[model samples]
Target chain A: MNESWDEIGQLFKNARSIVILSHVRPDGDAYGSSLGLAWTLRALGKEVLVCNEDGMARSYRFLPGSEEVVSTPKTAPQGCDIVIAVDTSTQERLGPTFALWNRKVDINLDHHASNTCYGTWNLIDPLAPASALVCYKLLQALGWTCPKEAASCFYVGLLTDTNAFRFCPLSPDVFRMAAELVEQGADPLSLSEGAYRNYSIGQFHLLREILAQTVFAWENRVAYYRLTPALLKQTGAENTEVENFLTYLQKVSTVQVAFMLEELEPNLTRVSLRSRAPIDVCQIAQRFGGGGHPRASGIRARIPMAEMEKLLLEEIRQVLQ
Target chain B: MNESWDEIGQLFKNARSIVILSHVRPDGDAYGSSLGLAWTLRALGKEVLVCNEDGMARSYRFLPGSEEVVSTPKTAPQGCDIVIAVDTSTQERLGPTFALWNRKVDINLDHHASNTCYGTWNLIDPLAPASALVCYKLLQALGWTCPKEAASCFYVGLLTDTNAFRFCPLSPDVFRMAAELVEQGADPLSLSEGAYRNYSIGQFHLLREILAQTVFAWENRVAYYRLTPALLKQTGAENTEVENFLTYLQKVSTVQVAFMLEELEPNLTRVSLRSRAPIDVCQIAQRFGGGGHPRASGIRARIPMAEMEKLLLEEIRQVLQ
Candidate 1:
């Protein structure tokens, strides 16, 4: 059910023990929203537990209350009066944690338009720049002040989800919320440093190798890079470190479409696509049984890396033409 | 003399024609502030002319009213009743344009801590994130709303000056002002795309070459790169395109100090230095007759590229120790 902020506030206020869960392989938003809500609840003298299927990434360990988040619940789900999912778009996104707790989710807080709303009460604002902003607004609606730790966590969520305010259609409210969060002790520099600037030496090496191998096509309007397991092994960089390297290609002035062909296995390739405005990369990805937003999308092809590249390039060329 | 906002507002209100000037090698802030103030003054039914020594860079040509900014004044400066300098720190920084205007500057608006009170009415707020922001506050204090074009220009100034809000000590007021600017018609995505995302293909190639040749020292705590004229010719990139690539080295988690040795000439090497907190690169830069902030500095040595590299590495190693 689509519930109002007042209803959600009442539900939280009445609950003695609440458990928060986020998506698998949790990003800053997932951990940030979960921990932010946890900190706010604990400040209200309520028992709060935060959990994620994959736990926290090393980069986000500096966030307050990160140490308290558990991969597995120590207590029974039945003992908690409320089970709230934060930043998780669908029930399955909770991963293995969803199977462990079979009860109906009491609340679902999210900003994603794709949210399935499987909870008994759902608060989804697609206009919200980030899920953390939704949590901040919910606290405001309840006449409760966000704790300092919660403010920092929410700021991280806002910072990373928006690509440090680069990607989002930044609204007045987004900046206002950011301002209030800063006033409440959210350090933008430190949070951004911890989230974006912390790159390993191995990651740096991997970036170098990837850029060195970049190929441009169609009057330099399209750029693509191939990442192989051999390259990963040679650079000693994890796959996760390659998540944002496609941005390097996208930033090129003449490039309209930028993609990465990552060889996942002997005959399987995962392709990530990004394009500028007026070009829908999601349509290109959908042709290969994959999908995402208009500007950014992904596909997993059951073909060799070269074959996948050829097929994707043909599709992108048609769009460019 | 230092002037109050009301006094500056009255001076602008009374002026019939105003000439605005920015420093040499104009950046986003320089042009943004000049154009933003021009648009505001035009909206107030005042005749305004914006001039710069180097004119606007090709990248910032997308900004509103950019075409109006000229490298040389069309009419004599004496024809204008007021001469205002925006974002230019010192009087000499205004370059040859200062000599063109023999009259005393009526108003000097800036956010640089090193700004000299060169105007009859000077409003320098070092705490302000950008000079455009100071102009925004001045308009607000005069009960004037920022025009849409001016808002976009000011947004660019703030966005670029703060490195997309990454470098500034983001206080509540900064975000609040940004929120106001966005509400008044600053499209953040388009503005940021124009300001930062537009990198030439040659620039991308230069970045790739620079990364490929990166050298790490002191257990990866110090990373440096050499950019010779041959590399520039090979990549087909202009020297202007190499301004921000030092950030690539600074982002490595293990790197405390990152520098770039650019071979400006066969016997002249320009070295740019950047370091994290608790390390003062300005001191190191000062030893070579150059200076800047503690974290970011530069030096131009008449030494050859190889000799300059060796000497700078020795200085950096001592600091690292």
Candidate 2:
């Protein structure tokens, strides 16, 4: 009775409680997918629990069930019914809470190119933006009229993942799904502001700080900046601000390569690279066991902060040359 | 004999001198159109002169014939048989030399949307990028294959005016003409660097100065930055630096409306505004007698610089609210 999607819907109909979980370091797609799925499940007469390891980013407050996300263990009871994971491709990313359940049965949903098929009942499609888009379609298949809450959740996920379709990483099915979501009342202005307008005072100061320290590696047509922990503290900025600063650097005149190194610990570092031209920062990132697309990528290069900066700069120069 | 296309080609076939003049603010299109036209004419046995208003930005130094541009006139012999004015839709944009010529005796080609139909033999198709794209076709009309030099010239204009297709302010015909120019000998990579690379230290320093004075009209999501004459002087920055700073303010996280107020004079200010979303800054720019696109635009307003800043900021804020 629990094998197929029809069976899954029947399980939802029978279950009294549901908890939707997304990966840590939640992004637009991750956050959107979680909220959209939770909203849909709640509409199916299930008491839903949307849980994440970290807090929601300030920008996504407009999402329907975003505020309801419970990050602490105190909120969940012994049994959380059938747990559904969204946007998470691996168990480690679920991060330290895999034991929170008393071996509850789970359904995993995701849309990453490298899905690990982690859940007991895995439904991974690398083509969708957020699992929420897939979740939205599934609810439709189950004969659910997407309530306003569910619609808003899916809309937020679609909006953020696509950057209003500026740099869509999704397939054709994603946009067709997005169009249907918009027809059901997705406000483009609000969506744009929620995803793009969200920035903090410290983040803006961080931008100025890093930009001031920006070293244009003119010979390589590369530009880079670093955010040491001390510097981040000095500017009262976070790791995320370093991510946004690199976005601005990528647009510099004649600059095809951009790198930002953030101090994760006193000695360890995290590297984020973006290339506007044909250079492959992905392969560079993959050398450190991290992976991403050709245009955008990240790597957890666990070298001393100073050496990591030098290594990345020299590495990019050598590789691209 | 002077009216037929072949007669014009035959007339230039024996000419000892020809003056090549492009419009002021010689953009890629203007440079491409004129330079390509000149080389094609030169190859067909005409003595060609590429004259312009001033030294091009260093970013343009790699363009073909860029080094030979005549910013200041030296000596001119008796009149040549042909004078081609390119990317110059209006006589005023051609400056002092344009006023000295008789409209009935000169050949003009342009692609300005607001071209005033001001030439004796005007080829005004506002849809094209630089007059150079049209000039490429004219090379074919003159029964000449685009020589390398001619191809490079046209490449510069095409790269500049189209902003390398990042700013597609032209029609499809313009791109098709550009394709033919590339096939003729346009090296897009070198052309991309020559047109967009080669950033000067002064420009980068000026960029830093502009970021220092960034301010936000917070409630309406309008942010503006000041680039005072003092800032430019302190940094030893060129006017081109101000052009580079044009989009800086618009990129602020919460900024939907961005303005850069450059003090061209104590009472005169050049306001450049950019928008990421759909709020049209052009409507605000046009209200003040300036016109441009919705996303990117400019306005020249004369008032005390500070007052002009306040007034313009308030005016733009009204739109968002």
Candidate 3:
């Protein structure tokens, strides 16, 4: 059993009410973790409420307990013994459930390197593949059977964060745990369709336009593509449609640093950078006060595109030099 | 400088004929390594003869020296000073050029963990991401400028083998070499289109079916999906469609042991497995005399579907236990 998991197991055992919350506009990892944990808690005969800042997409409904998720933070259950944030880092990221934490013990479970330790008992291992992985460890330490539905939820969380075992830098232990889950009945077909094939036609069209608009610079070693707010408005694609677009930029053969800049507003750009090798975007992102993993890191900088490009090029160039 | 790279550089300085051969049904790693190395040799004023068993896909045409490749083994120059097998490990995997190596000095450069060490000079480091990375190091040690073209080829090899940095258990050295390649101008946009978005509609449709049909044995904690010859024939998808299908399976949260069973014949199956942790598929595969890396491993066995399933389940059960 993982260290500190015993405490988490006891925390679940003693709790009369639990509210499970994750980051706003939750990713597969966050949503999966919250639901997986909630499912296991419910299986254990506890009253568990799962919530997020926003509603989940249609594709993710296959998750066993997704239908029970309540999106509005203001509707959070009162007087919970514990409030667990699955993958949310900042308080602002907690959305409606932001207030729920003030009334009870806050347990933060995250894998982000930038976690602020806002919870009383912070379990933030940046090296962890996903929040569900953390939840799985807690469940395992508690000696729970980890029902089939719960295992599936955890599996989805692991695979999504790791990009299907291609990026998360998962350890041998992750796979072993996953194997145990599979034995318990996690369906890959359902997860893949939910996770990877969730790419709607709208996202596909948006991808085509972004690909066409790609720009090469610094003699092709540096390449970037962007999803403009105007295009999103034109396509009627939601803000979340822009998620995971950075993955598309990596196929280039000569690119050392790949950037996917999404325009959030007139002057705000969310920059996602993936380094092929040697360049740690975490360090680069830290300079901008935004950070993520070493390979794929992001920084949200509010500035004109022209200025943003120049500053970013200068910053990235510094790392290369 | 790499110990023997100077020897290769010197060989290029004095030798006029060079034959580049790659592994069978060459992938991006194999093709990229061959093309990256051939371009470097050509830059040194050598007459390069590149041959392989696989037909070139249009996506690969963008490779720097791809336009110069020869598919027939007969085109190999006679009495070449050195025959560089860029990414081939075993002799049979050398494809059509296996016989030619009998008459020449074969320098095998590979990154496969299952390398057979068949060359007079074997450069096999499973830890390295790809043979293209090795080729880049060799070129660097030779003090050659990694032209934009060479970088492009090297990038493809690295990008593909690492599954875009998802597959390769990369280290600091890989990134450093990537930085050197970037200094010489590798265009990422073109590479993305060539390597990723180039998937055909047929392949996409096939992927959809595979995603739909994936099966998860929750009790055994093994998730599996299969593609039958009948299914491929019905869908008009080929073995090539199997390329990225395993990635879809690897995403399932509950599946620790993810597998793709492709029917090679009436009763033959090509089993590809991806593990998240404790299970070493390589050792598991070696039980059937097949082998691969610890996390992602493979084996080809001809057995009844029921028997194969049972055997695989038994092994998986043991690995999980």
Between prediction 1 and prediction 2, the one with superior TM-score is 1
Expressed as tens digits, the lDDT of each residue in A52-115 for candidate 2 is 7876766577676678887836345655678788877676677576555445337887767666
What is the full ranking by DockQ, best candidate first? Answer: 1, 2, 3
Best by lDDT: 1
TM-score of each: 0.93, 0.63, 0.56
Candidate 2 segments exceeding 4 Å error: A1-4, A72-76, A102-105, A129-132, A136-144, A163-173, A253-256, A276-282, A292-295, B1-208, B216-222, B228-257, B265-267, B273-298, B304-307, B310-321
Worst 10 residues of 1 chain B by lDDT: B70-79
- Candidate number achieving the greatest TM-score relative to the actual structure: 1
TM-score attained by model 3: 0.56
lDDT of 2 by residue, B72-184 (tens): 25444356666667877567667665455543426777766566666556666555656676677666777777898787788677656544443233343444555555566
Candidate 1 structure quality by residue, lDDT tens digits, B1-321? 366767777777788998899887777888899999899989999999888887767778989999988885644656588888998777877877567656677789998876778888888898888899988877887888689999999999998887777744879999999999999999998887787678888888899989988899989999999998899999988776475787788778778899989888899988889887778899999899877667777788898999988888888889884
Q: Which of the two candidates, 2 or 3, achieves a greater TM-score against the reference?
A: 2
Native contacts, share recovered per candidate? 0.80, 0.09, 0.02
Alpha-carbon DockQ of candidate 3:
0.04
Say which docking band candidate 2 falls in: incorrect
Candidate 3 lDDT by residue in tens digits, B1-321: 123766655666777887778866678988888888887778878788888877565557767778778774644467677787777767667775457545543577887767787777777777687889878767766777666788878978887777654533445455456545555666544564567745443454465566556676755357677778777876666576374667655543455777877777767777888876566888888897677678777778877665777788788877774
